[model samples]
Target: MKKIIILLLIITKISLAFEDCIDFFKKERYLQAKQCFSQINQTDPLYPYALYYLLRTRVYAEEDYSDLLPEMEKFKNTAVYSYFYLYLASINRFKNPKLALEYWSKIDKEALFKDDIPFYYYLKYQIDKSLKKDPIKEAKKISLYFPYDRFYGYPVVFENINILSEEEKFNVLDRLAAKRMFTKAIYLLPYIKDGQKKYLYSALLYMKNREYQKAEYFISLLKGKYRASAVYSYIFFQRKMSEKKKYFKELLKYNDKKLIWKAANYLMKKSFYLQKYKDFFYYSQFIPEKSRYYSNKLWFLSLYYYIHGKKNKAAEILEKNIRYFSEKPKVYYWLYLSYKDINRTKAYKYLKKAASIKKIDFYVIRAREKLGLPLFEGKPMFLKFYQSKTLDMIAKLKPIDYKAAYIEARYFMKKHGVESIAAVFPELAARKLSDRKYLVRYAYPKPFLKYATDNLTYAIMRRESFFDPYVVSFANAVGLMQIIPPTARWIAQQKKDRNFDIVQLFEPSKNIEYGRWYLKYLDRMFKGNIFYIAGGYNGGDGTVRRTLKRYEIKNIEEFVELLPYRETRYYVKYVYTNYKAYQTIYGRK
Candidate 1:
């Protein structure tokens, strides 16, 4: 009994120590994390994780390369061996190209971690370029297939593609234009042989730079169908229309499927802005059946019909098209509301159907409330280790061995519905498998809560950036709370924190601090209304205020459904949903 008690105490200490080490690593305090990792007992279950962190710590710190080769050699037979060698190769790429190339060739590309995949391709491009190999082919491959956005801006391959034939160059330029890399496309315009493509891109380039006169010069160069294209009409739409009849005639002449789709999408927003529901419904029909926006068009058009006292028409359209939408609970709820005046039986049937669905979306919650159903609960699952060859291997070797095996088995497991063996790795499982438990503990760490001037701050953090301290949005909103630089500066000024720098926003504690302050500020401005606070947080305060003034909002949900910007509308729903979920989970209500 005494021996068992001693064992339990030791295990407790190790678990707590490992947690602290992981926390340090996540916060980017590499040196502290390394020190914490170094203190773990070699016999502990997490000893392998400590070693992995120690190696990563050295790499992150830019320490001497001498220890790297020796350390990598020591772990050459381990599961993460490729990861180690790849790190060494990446750091040595420019400094010692020969040695880097050798290591790169030795490392197994398929064994790389998810974060390292993109970097591997990036290094491949750089190394092949240095070796005078066909770097263009490598770059093209990466640019076409890499799943993530470029961390280092556009790859150097674009510059080298200039040496290819004019037609090939034009194809590449066209791809760049489609991706909205306007500057890059313009830079390669001299290499395009096609006069029309050149003129179009030149006009786009000048328009992007806000040089309207120069843009008009290139626009004048377009003739015939190109003149009636969406491109010319778009420019005219931005400028004053001296002759409305002529403008509408040319704009309505867009027979190109792509242009018609674009014009219809634009008109949806324009008609809404002008409060012309009839015109909005007219343009919505032109949206292609295959377009991603088609379902949105259906929902809004049905909504217009319902608002204009055409309930039968709304029900007809919704019944015909509800299957196209992925948000079934929301669609069913809308169907229920639409049928209330027409068929009482169908209304209750759809209401009960929507309530029974398990999704945690806004409509699911509302449907449950209407039917007196309980809130959705996520029960944690556990699987005990079994007596198998795989388990035997995992028991005798490093946890990373199990991690590598699990990664390789993902497709098999996914297809066969076998449980993820990733949960078998103690360190990795602690981060990924537990869902809400780990998310709350790591993301909404208790230390940060003391800084919250508003209780909803942590909930907002989850919705904003999912507590990823390194996250950055397309709009350049950085860190956990997704605060843009200007907002961070404003918060700093309000607090008289003159020493606060923008880079500090990446710290979880600091981000939560600033975020809470902003939330409190918004609360005061919005007069403690959570819906308005959430809306103002996602869409600007000015936009929310203008929207409120523009419409008679008898129902918040209805108003949200009609929001002009799709993202902002969803943002309000997501933020509030997250807030409610948090309240329900923690018994905070």
Candidate 2:
């Protein structure tokens, strides 16, 4: 009895000391963290973690960690050892290229964390270049894996541009344009041919950068279909009514269905807003029935006729196109609304069709509410059995290394998306866990439940980072809530938090708190409208205000459909759906 008690006490002490070291590390008290980590005995199960963090502490403190390399290597074949090798290689890449190569050779490239693969290729290219070896292979690898990586990918590809194929060069250009790296992309254009493509890219780059005059210079140089498309885009951005109408009229001469659909859609919306029924009808004819925008075109046309006291025409349009949108609940719901007073039997038929689709979305929710049905069907009976079986399988298989699973899961989620979590734990797949409740719980985890329980918070976090607190976006938005550094700093100042560092935004607790505060700030700015609040969170308050002021937003659905920014439109839909899903799953509605 005494022996067991003594062992328990020793384990407890080790756990507490290790946690203190972690706390010190998180607080950036590197010296204290180093000392605490060093005190951990090698016999403890956390010894590997202590050694790893001790090395990390030195690195974070900007101190030489060459001495820790020998100690780190003692845990050969371990995840911590692999990470240390990569870190040392990265830090030594410039200072001691040969030594960096030596460390790099020790890493198993295939076993590397997905995020680390880009850096691994980067270090390989650097080593190849230093040794005067052929680096084209490494450069191609970098370009293929991380084409938009400004720091590593751009440099390698640019340096090796002379040897690259035309296709590879164009790939780099496409990625650069997509990422808005116009300056670097411009330098590559002089070397590549294809005048039409180049002019279009240049015009698009300037246009997207909001330099309308610069875009027009390139647009003037373009001709034929390219000119028509560029002019349409330029007018769309420039918002000159005369130029818009001129280019939109010219666009109809081209046989391109995409451009025609775009022109017609814009004109249709404009005509609807202006109450020009004849013009609206003319433009609506150009919208191809096969285009993706056709359903939206139908919805707007139906809405226009309905509001203009032509209810029968509205129902007729929806019924004519109902086959194309059989799976879309919004169309069904809208059709129901059109027939509610005109034809009660038809209205209930469409309502039942919308509500019985077995999907959870805005329209489905509205349809269910109209029928007084439960928002969520009750949890499936198989979910409990599946959970039990998954636990048993995990215990039996022991497929995942729990010690390293969290870090691996974060990287996996970032690379493959949250739906791919089951890949990290084979037991989940082996048990064939297909319960919607479990899947939703995994994808939209509420790790910061202690900070906030409102569905909005989790919904935002799920959309932003899928609960990966260390994830950083291309815009430099850090952590679970994807708060940019400037915004986080401003939020900190607003709360009078003197010691708040931007680095703290990577911490889940601080990120969630700051994000929640920003949401409340948006709530006040947008009068607690979830659509505007969500749109403001993603597209900024100015964008939300401009959209609300510019459009005749009669309701939430129309506002979402008419949001100027496609990203914001999808963002609002996703976040709102997430909010509704959370409410349904947690019984909060």
Candidate 3:
């Protein structure tokens, strides 16, 4: 009995130790994880995973591929035997194409994890292409596995994309457009050589570039009535308010639903700047009742009427539009208020329903406050660290090993829902081994963090790259902070660092240092307004300043919502949101 109890205790200790190792692995402390895995007994259930990680850390993370032969030999007959073959193929794929092909052919791809499939296909294509396989067939076959956005070890050289046939070019163009790589899509135009496709691509490129005149010219060249006129009107709709309003009035002459839909969208945004209740209410007639903007328009209309002391109009609009905005707690709260003067029972019913729903948004908190319930129960219990057997297998491969668990966490969040973001936010923020935390430590070497406030720094870092040091944005922004090469050079010059090479921007410590210094600089320029700071960081200082000058921003919220670029508008909001989450997590508030 004493021996059995001792054995049980030992097992529990090993289990706890394994969990700790996994936490280190998840954190990307590969060296420490390797150490932890090295100490595990050979007979343990997790021993295979330990051995795999130990070899992987040595080869991939440490970049000491010299003595992997011994380790490779040991894993050959194990359940994870395929990984040994894969590692050899990956390292030698370019240098020894024949040997790499031999290694690749040894593996059973079906036995690999789902995330590993893309890497396998990508590597196989490279190997096959290097061995002089038919270019057309190889391009078509590999296009199936092409990632929408960037991925580790995916060859992004323009030559690879340039070789695709015309049909394949269109297919890849569609995918590139979906990924918002419009600039890269333009590269395919020379090869595409079709007039209509070239015209469409030109219009899209100009639109993306925000050169409306060029956009209008190309859009005019489109053949079809539906595509041409709609795009032409959209160009006008995207212009200044005065310009768009004139186009909107002219588009009203057309009986086309697309034109009408565009007009309604225009009115919805325009109404905010007009800010006249009566004018918007009058204009609301043009918007179709079934249009997506209809409910949001009614929401604004009802609120405006209530504010203007027209309770009858407010109640009428709210009652009619309640179904359309049911998911919005403010809608329920407003509907309750609308019923207050006429029906006390109905008012109480709606209020009660509104207060029952729990969310962190303004209306939910207001409803809870009105009901005398706690504003929130507590911060969410973030989902527990999750691991599975397949992840263990995936973690055995180089480079992919580093991202495997992190990718699984992302997949887990998607499988659950958006609410899972709160549960996984910390993991997402710190998932990559070379993430912001690693970079920030170098930036703030002293006892007290400096340059930028910790929360703000974290927010910017998360927004920039989600801690991916290797990330290069479609706009040619590089490294963890996504600093464009021109800006990086300027930053280098400003710092008077003569040794600053453009390639060094890809280095984590250098990237973070430069990024933080720029933030400090922007903080001075924007006078500490985070909205302006974030907007400047994303959409150039001049753009942010020009927008601010153009409009009399009623508040920070108004300024953020009305920013010219849709991407920059959301960029500020997301960064601020991330800052708040960082404060909550780190108790930095």
Candidate 4:
């Protein structure tokens, strides 16, 4: 027993030391991390990890890691051998391309870290090019899997684009546009030979970037059905009501089903917003029953008629089209609301059906609230003793082989954050585990609890970056809380923090601090309305205030649905759902 106690103490000490060194590495204090790593005794179980990170720290610091290559053979029998091989390949790539290729050839590509996969392909492309071999496949993989890898991917794609097929090129262009890398898309435009495709993409890119005049120029250069599509898009971005109505009506005359659908969808929403029942019904007919928005059209028509003192007509519309909705919690809730006034028995039936839906969503929660049922039904006790199967498996390895894998998993979690552990261990990705204790905890982690422990804080964090402290969004929002640099800087000034830098926003504590401060400020501005707070967080507070004044918000549900910005509307719903989920899971309520 005494011997076991001593061993446990030694293990605890090693774990603490390894975690401390990892903290230094995460903070980019390479020298300190290296020193910390160097201090671990060779006999310790964690020594292999310490040595590996010591070499990694050197690579990150851009210092000479060649001397450490001889020491890296120690990693061959360890779990981190794949990473060492990757780093080894990266180090020798430019100096001795053959040696890098040799090292890379020994690695199990499947074991490469998620973030490193792009770089691996990148190196393969470079080596293939250096050897005068066709690198089309590697280039395509980088473009498809990691186009946002600005260092290697974008540069490689721009250089080798001529070799890609037209379909592949269009795919790359579409991905770049989706990632909002419009500058790269614009740069590639000169390479596209097809005039129609080029013109359409150019207009779309310019419109996405909000360069309306440039977009209009490109749209003018277009012709035929494509030009009509472009005009509809251009009109969609403009605020002129007369122009929207005119072109949308003109769009209805075109035989292009997609453009007709888009025009009709827009006009339906607009007419509903303006209470033009005639125009709303006119446009609603153009919406195909096959369209996903068809149900939304039905809902809007029902609401319009219901509000205009036609309750029986509203019930008939909902009952007739109820089969169209695959996810019917919201539809059922709406039916309950519509029927409660005229027929309580029918209302109760619909309310019970909505509350009984297995899925938990905004409407489901509201229905449960009305029925006095538990908002969520799950085993919260599962979290109390939760332990990841991957870590447990690692712990069962031979003592000499255990710590490296353990540290590897922990380091991956630290770097990538949240569900990234599953990325490292594919077994964790099983759908069966989604509702299990581990995944539930993973889906709703409570990081930075000391800074702010509220359900809303965790909800926002889950939605913002999924607890990824180093994540930078397309809009340049940083860290777990997704605080923009300008907002973070302003927050620093408000707090009188003299030494604060925008880079600190990538630190979890500081990001959460600034984000929570901003949330509190919004709370005060909006007088504690969560819907407005969430909308303000995504859209601006001014937009939320204007929306509240523009629409007579009867309730939170109506306000969320009516939010003009689709992103903000969804953002509000997601944050609220996350908040409620957290509350339910943790028994906070």
Candidate 5:
């Protein structure tokens, strides 16, 4: 390896293909580099360079040297011979460093590129010093090779000192220290590549020796740059410098956002653990306003409100930001308690309002169950259209597929039931549905000017099903609104004054009308708790009501924190997302 590196360093006639192969080899693409080297047209005079690459390829490829051994015999007694010998010696059979050193020793140091001497010395130094055989002999051997090397350069040549410099020594020390090649690190210090490595390694060595003062002096060089490196992170954490906690204030100057966030949280935690709230406040600007984390921040301060005996101010902080919760239900639940403790009416009102929307389903269901009200949900409505087999099907055959459980609406339609249909009605969100037309035509409140005039629900339907006239879930729900057949039949009977069979629920028009009515009922019954509605839609109102019995608790936050099931959690999220999409895309907020 030393001979190869040395040859590489001085080659004035480097072939592009050889360089390309080297690049590929370093990238770990051994086969490609081998191929590049092999493909280097024998016609080129640089075949020796290509052959050198091929020699190294077998090492990386971990292939038997026999495949390339015949070719190796041709390169004996040349500059290449030394490299081949060194390469052979490096192949460990049983991790036998001494045996490998034998082949390396055979290298004719007398027949080498002077520039290759440092690399050779370094590799030999690594092996000898690592094995702890004899440092004095190894160091003396290193000097023989790197006589020109500064500082570590010793046992003078008959001529003046060699060209080795301070910088070279520093780098060598850096490599040795980094590799945990401690013997080499200590012995090769005068040849280190830079003073920083000397400082870093000295600090590491001192710390290992429990010489804290020397360690401090070494890392103290980093007074200005310590904040910018992973080194600080290692030192601060691994050293457990509890007393030097104040020193990390300098780390704030580092600009890595991720690291900063971690640092900020760490500082905040340290302050809390140390019972130093004023210290924690130093990073108040980076604090997340989200309830869970911010609440923790408040808890850490303790003096913010609770500790100061100003319960009212703390309660107000919770309320003003409850609705902005990153974790909705949990946040609202806390705010509910704060309000209830100070003002009962406000708390109930806030609780009811929270129950209406969907973020906090468990809490909402429990709230409605306690209130003896039916579940709240956006009523499902199936669209029904009747026409002879002659009418043309629309281009968007089943837009609900695009809904992908994502709901949206159609503004204008011109097929199935009648002439051009536009969902411009102000009252309902969109056009009339088709599932159960019978219910819409008769039961749609006779003063019914509202039914005829409003199509607000139609817009909501688009986001729900995309007007797919026929759809069903495993629950026996059918058609666009995804209404369960039994539920539809019951809803239809009350509105139309006539009972209908479950099969008729498949009819687009009848299914839609009944579905829409059920949706409206759910919405009103649960007082707008979107969460309960989505859950009831999937798991049924009975399940929600049943769950509520075990849900009562003094801490509202504790009540909602306990609901399990990932799907229900997301079900509530998407439904509200649908609501927001409807409002944003169609302006029906």
Candidate 6:
């Protein structure tokens, strides 16, 4: 009995010693943990953890590249990491890159950790490249996902072609042409058989190479099948009008309203005086309900009456057309003239309406001066919508300058009704009153600042450009909110400003004005779905649309999680980071 009791005591002592070592290791006392792990030779899960630390400490302690290899191997075999990349990528294997490549080759390239895939594929590609005897063939092995390879001179053409068709295909084809690879792309069209697609590509190719006859030939072939398509017919008409007046005159025989309109325009251009006015009426009556040509037709019709010296008749046409077209600049231009000639009061009313909306368009300016309309100098148009939870989240993640936080708070209070802004009001006041005179320092608009109290947006701003107004991203976006040039120009056009140049978009007032409009536009494009809108803003509207349709995202959060673009994924993270930082500093509503 005494011998058995002594044995139990000895067992208990050893067990306690092991537990003590684990405790020390948990405390990160690596040297002590290493010794304890060595004492046990049974090879347990804890064995790996201890060994990983042992190698890591050895590498740190000795700073020897030679020792790094074996230690890495042992550690990989022992320790459990989140990805266990160290196990697969142990430095000891570097001496035999062939063996290392062989080992890495066996790894499921598609089953990599989310952040590690790009690097993994890049590494594999590098290895394959190193081993390749034929550099030309190896060069073609590059990932189909990325564009811009002057070496191969391949953009996303081959990859994009496999999936898109019709209008979508044409969009891609245009992009390919923009890259100056249209002639090369012609050879690729043989793999596709859609008639419209074939005709379109053929026409583009012929047009670029100055083969007008071939272009006409290809377009004629498509007319029988795609005659109902106004756009296609219109395209054909334009080409034919330039090259063959006889054929252009023959095309007017078609009874289709859009085609008739095209014919009438052609007749008018060719000085067919007897038939021009009659054909114009036929064309005018056939304009589609949603036709972009409606305003132009109204203007032309009203002008015809005015030039024929039918004053009352012209006024009636102007009134009817103005009501039909709403505030369109073209209609307004004619109406302003009609009203000035007939009744100054009516002219002033319509001109004021046009000027108040915008005074920069050609027609609007004419109307404004004729009626002596007041300038639209009131407080700027703005938008508001922010959730506290969303704002709080932003504050935790984003970085916001002093004045930005203040302005964002004000916006939340006014637009989103986020009561959280009150808590941070003092900070906002301090910053606004600060003596700092730097450009863009205190230049943040009140509404924009308030809206930006979002956590992610503020955090993202820091990493994006340190809030520099002039920072232009690789994608050609500028200003604090990073508005794209094309998008800015579009917004300016919508607001009736023809002079809004894309180059001057970095100006603070212009940048924010257009940036907010773009955000709103994106929001609308995604159906007020913030996640998709955010993704759309970062990746592309088309990409976000495709992804949403691909994943069939019914919920914004799920869509965000499923985004294929890592840039978009990180952008979401960064936007929320900015929002969180804003919420934190501003003390969320």
Q: Pick by TM-score: which candidate is best?
A: 4
Give the per-residue lDDT of model 1 (tens digit) for 161-256. Answer: 555666555556556555556666676666566677567667766666556676667777876566556254553345443332244446666566
TM-score of 4: 0.78
**TM-score of candidate 2 against the unseen true structure:** 0.77
> Which ranges in model 6 have alpha carbons more than 4 Å from their true place?
1-174, 177-181, 190-200, 220-223, 227-292, 307-312, 328-333, 352-373, 380-589
- TM-scores, all candidates, are 0.67, 0.77, 0.58, 0.78, 0.27, 0.38
Q: lDDT values of the candidates?
A: 0.65, 0.73, 0.64, 0.74, 0.50, 0.50
1-589 per-residue lDDT for model 3 (tens digits)? 9999999977855665766777788798988787777777765545655666676777657466545455545544333556667877887888888999988987766446554766776778778778887545544555534635356222432446666666666777667666677676666567667577677767776677576787777766776654446454564537576656555665666567666675665565556545644546555776677777777677667756665567678878887667787556667777676677878887878787777775544345556667887544343223345554433433442123334434443453444443343222332434432222112222211111332447787778777887665677778899778999999999999999999998888666688899989999999998999889999999889878887786665456446655767688778866875665555446564
Best of the candidates, lDDT: 4
Better of 1 and 6 by TM-score: 1
On the 0 to 100 scale, the lDDT of residue 360 in model 6 is 25
In model 3, state the lDDT of residue 519: 91
Better of 1 and 2 by lDDT: 2
Between candidates 1 and 6, the one scoring higher on lDDT is 1
Residue 451 C-alpha lDDT in model 1: 51
Worst 10 residues of 5 by lDDT: 400-409
* Predicted candidate 6 versus true structure: per-residue lDDT over 510-544, tens digit per residue: 66566666666787776766566667778778878
lDDT of 2 by residue, 442-546 (tens): 444454556788899988887787766677887878988999999998998999999999988867678999999999999998888988999999989988887
Candidate 2, residue 192: Cα displacement in angstroms equals 2.8
Residues 1-589, model 4: lDDT tens digits: 9999999977855665666888888899888888778777765655656667888888777877666667657655344666777777777777878888898887766555455678888888887777777778888888766776788788878777888777777788888887788888888887888688779988988887778789878987888877888878866876667767776766666678877887788878887766577888988998888876798798888877766668778888998899987758877887887787899999999999998887757788889889999876674322223254434434433233322443455554454443555533322222223452122544565645567778988888878876656678888889878988888888889999999988878666788889999999999998988889999999989878777786666667667766767678788887887887788767673
**TM-score of predicted model 6?**
0.38
Candidate 4 backbone clash number: 0
